[model samples]
Target: MLTGIVEIVPGVSLLKGRLSSHETTQMLQAEGLAESDLIPGKYEGILLLKAGAEVHFQDYNQEVLRALTAPNVAANTAASGQHAEGCTLRRPRYFAGDWTGLPCLLEKEGLLATYDVILSAETVYNLDSQRHLLKCIKQGLRPKVGQAWIAAKSYYFGVGGGTASFIQLVDRDGTFEVKAVDVIDDGASNKREILLLSFKA
Candidate 1:
């Protein structure tokens, strides 16, 4: 099932996704797809899916897919087989400048709930502030159990940050262990990688 999707800002980081309208709702109707076939209460189905409950979706409006499924899949996985307090939904917050101030701000807002997993995509483009970024992650992650998933190009061309540079910082820290989760070479010049970071045991 498709889960969270983000839009990356070049030279900055990732942003929240906005679903666009579909131009061909007519074709779906012509295929004999009826509204009755769709699972009633889109948001209700979304909540159930987030709770690790499977919702057998027949067919529905394509544009509403994300509106109905924006809950973090990581939360679902983290909550799986656990008790009620396992899931979390971290809202999008604007921490535009250096991340050094992020920890205090999040804490002040009473939003400092730590998690078992955190996901970031295409966010390693700033070289100078890498330490601050890691510091913010350290402040909000559960010490031994939390893992950060970073998906990015192996190297960012014009920018100084990428998976290698970020991994170098993480290795130098000695607090976290880095592992190569996956590498995708989509016939592109720079291959993409999924790196997992966990506190060293």
Candidate 2:
């Protein structure tokens, strides 16, 4: 009975020839960016689609379904002492817009405060977009039971937005309680963390 929608943007055609991973890295290096650098409003950190990178709606839909239904699956199995029945998930509706404009967009679609959970990754690296992101989450999440899980690095090297700063913003807003559910430190890069946000009772 839980329905959901996800924003999707049509793939942009690469005007030039496709580049391999190494070639793309070299090109980004020429532009003063390493392979992992996200320049925010300049580069989104995704490789060129023309370089054989592809994103499918089905893949996104599966991920969303898994994230939202995993707990239910476990609970159902535990209660029944058997595997839960498989159910078909509805294809998520799609909209395209910038984070600053997403809340309004969702409102126009009659989806305001409708979601039980929201998931995002590597989206907090831009300091300028964090407020907008928070606004969208605040307006979209259903009351009490709604939650959002954001996965990002402990700090973004060049950009100012990180889990620490975002947590401060959440505290200032006074709308949600935020906690780190997981931390990953491989010593190979910046520490990563998954923060959970939920309405304060």
Candidate 3:
């Protein structure tokens, strides 16, 4: 059984258990000393861990219940965008990659991805996420973990149009983060880009 305040600064005591509802509530009260109105609240937050791990969380009072049943923290999530799940990040930051693919994971317990592997060497000059999506379509790339590919899309600069280059891929575990970047240079025509990063597998 994992225990913590759902909103400690807000004065809430959350709890969870493998027992009956009465037992779960009692366990929470014992942990937090509920002296207030004992208002009912649902576990409103979730942690987006990698796939293939089991986890359970519940919102009771203001405390969050995380069942420490497994090692994966990637599957059990209750919110969208960036989360404040880790011990750091103060107010939790929302990540763009998560917004694109994580919701489906929450619904299906795994990746809900499509494959389109129409890859382009022009990808080096244009690094937009949309371009990556298009390249996925062209190359029949299913976005499995570890394999790398390039994507192209347009970036608008005020009244003008600009192109970008981005390397996009999902690691084997289905965690998708940007692999590299090459902002288009009209003079250079999407020339070779520096290694922005290659996310860990």
Q: Score every model by TM-score.
A: 0.54, 0.60, 0.20
Best by lDDT: 2
TM-score leader: 2
**Worst window of 10 by summed lDDT in candidate 3:** 89-98
Order the numbered candidates by TM-score, best leading. 2, 1, 3
The local lDDT score (0 to 100) that residue 91 gets in candidate 1 is 29
Tens digits of per-residue lDDT, candidate 2, 4-39, equal 222222322111123467854554565223333332
Candidate 1 per-residue C-alpha lDDT over 1-201 given as tens digits, one digit per residue, 9 for 90 to 100: 333434222211112333323523443354334542333333322333333332322112432333343343333334434312454433222332236666787688664546566666666866876677788778767778988888888888887888889999999989899988999998956889999999999
Clashes of each: 0, 0, 28
Instruction: For candidate 3, write residues 61-85 as lDDT tens digits.
Output: 2233233212112222323432343
The 10-residue segment with the lowest total lDDT in model 2 = 53-62
Report every candidate's CA lDDT. 0.57, 0.60, 0.33
Task: Rank all candidate structures by their lDDT, best first, as comma-separated numbers.
Answer: 2, 1, 3
